[model samples]
Target: MLNNVAAVLLDGVHPFELGVVCEVFGLDRGDEGLPVYDFAVASAEGPTLGTHAGFTVSTPYGLDRLEAADLVVVPAGSTFATRDYPPELLASLRRVVDRGARVLSVCSGVFVLGAAGLLDGRRCAVHWQHADELARQYPRAVVEPDVLYVDADPVITSAGTAAGIDACLHIVRKEQGPEVANSIARRMVVPPHRDGGQAQYIERPLPRSRCDTVGEVLVWMERHLDEEVTVEQLAARAHMSPRTFARRFQQETGTTPYRWLLRQRVLLAQRLLEATDETMEVIADRAGFGNAAALRHQFVRSVGTTPQGYRRTFRGSQAA
Candidate 1:
């Protein structure tokens, strides 16, 4: 029943967000025996619209086209965070859901759905950068900033730019099957399914050198991830008591010494997985995980996938 689709655009639509929707539903992949959707872009503003990228996109379809859509997509716009959505467009969204259809929003497009009141009590996934504002604007919506996407049943929301691919593929996987979704993902040269949430992608800035701090200890920790070192030993090296060293470490790095070390180990393991052809056991030992089983456990917990899976993703299964 998931056939017809429409990507609704506003005045300042971001082309990449619009492209993600079009790539998922608008392409005619009949040559590969894929299900082709009755897809088109509909403009809320007018027939012609300017893109955030300083380009123009035209669509003959309008809000009327959304009425018949089995799935409706709202792509983020330049001022979606502050701009007002057209009331008619919001009404059409509500009507589409009322008629038992599904709706999806990429990035700030969730704001449009919020305006429609569709996300009133629903769990929503939004980019971390906008999560605060989204929560502020739609206090009733449960904003999950860490996740890549959330399938709040009829309403799907995704985080950031590429996460839209994750949401689209998830819907395809749900409706058609894993094979269809995977095939489409392969054609797009993206993963059919990503392992972890956005937490794995967030930047972890390490403390840098200054006159006196945990900078040298951090440098030592980074160099000696393969070795086992105690907080007492680190404290002794820093010429401070264990309690003071622990506090200073936490203050400077924004995390406990144990957590910082574990994260560093995981990071090293990731780099080794991506660039080296070492076996899991070897990589684990080098990264201080001790064994493959431990590596797999910690890797999955930290990266949302096994070391082998992560390696396969970053460096294809077959060696070059």
Candidate 2:
């Protein structure tokens, strides 16, 4: 039923985010018996817009194009979080939702929706880096920081970058069917449905310490991931009492020793799955999970997907 689609743009729009919307909606797939949307790029500011990447985009379509769209997408921009949107554009967005049409936002584009008051009392997803700011800016909106996307019916919000693709395909699947979405995904060379949240992609850096007391023990732990060891043993290796070692480890690494080891083991398993053709049993043994079941359990907990699924995703048909 989502036959008409429009992407509204502003100055300083991020090209990749805009491209995601266009690629999903603008392309003609009628040759494969897929639904091809009546898609157009509308300019909110003017006919000519400057991209964040130093390129210019010119479109003949204006805000009037949105009047007939079944879905309106707001792609991310460099200054969308802080900059004010056109009053007319915001009003047009409210009208679109009022008429029962869906509106989706990619990354910081949620800020524009927030400004339009569409996010009030609605759950939304944004990039983790901007989560706090979004919550502070729109106190009424529920900001889901760790999710890849949130579908609140008329208003859908996605996290940064490739998450937008997931959201777009989700809309297609919901309206048309999995067959259509899967076919489109096949052409795009992306997973039909990715199994993970933003938590796995978030970077957690270790805090710098003036004097790293547990540095030597940390190195030893990395090299001996296959060997089972205890916190008491690691404390002894560091020449400190267990309590002091745990405290220092937390201060230096921002996480407990057990958690650090678990994460590293999962990362090692990921490498082996991606770059090697080893069997699950061998990978589990090398990563210190001891067995395939244990490896699967911990891998799913850490990576948000099964080891086999991850392997199939990364290695494709060559993962045998």
RMSD for all candidates, in order, please. 9.5, 9.7
lDDT of 2 by residue, 72-93 (tens): 9999999888898899999999
Give Cα-based local distance difference scores for all models: 0.85, 0.88
Give per-model TM-scores. 0.64, 0.64
TM-score of 1: 0.64
What is candidate 1's lDDT per residue for 1-320, written digit by digit as tens? 78999999999899999999999898999999999999999999999999989999998999999999999999988889898888999999999999999999999899999999999999998888899999999999999987888888799999889888889998886676556787899999986665224341333233444546777877788899999999999998787899989988767644678888887788678767766788889999999989999999988987677778777665676841
- Report the error of model 2 at residue 72, Å: 0.2
The clash number for model 1 is 0
Give the runs in model 2 whose Cα sits over 4 Å from its true position: 195-320
The true-versus-predicted C-alpha distance at residue 35 of model 1, in Å, is 0.5
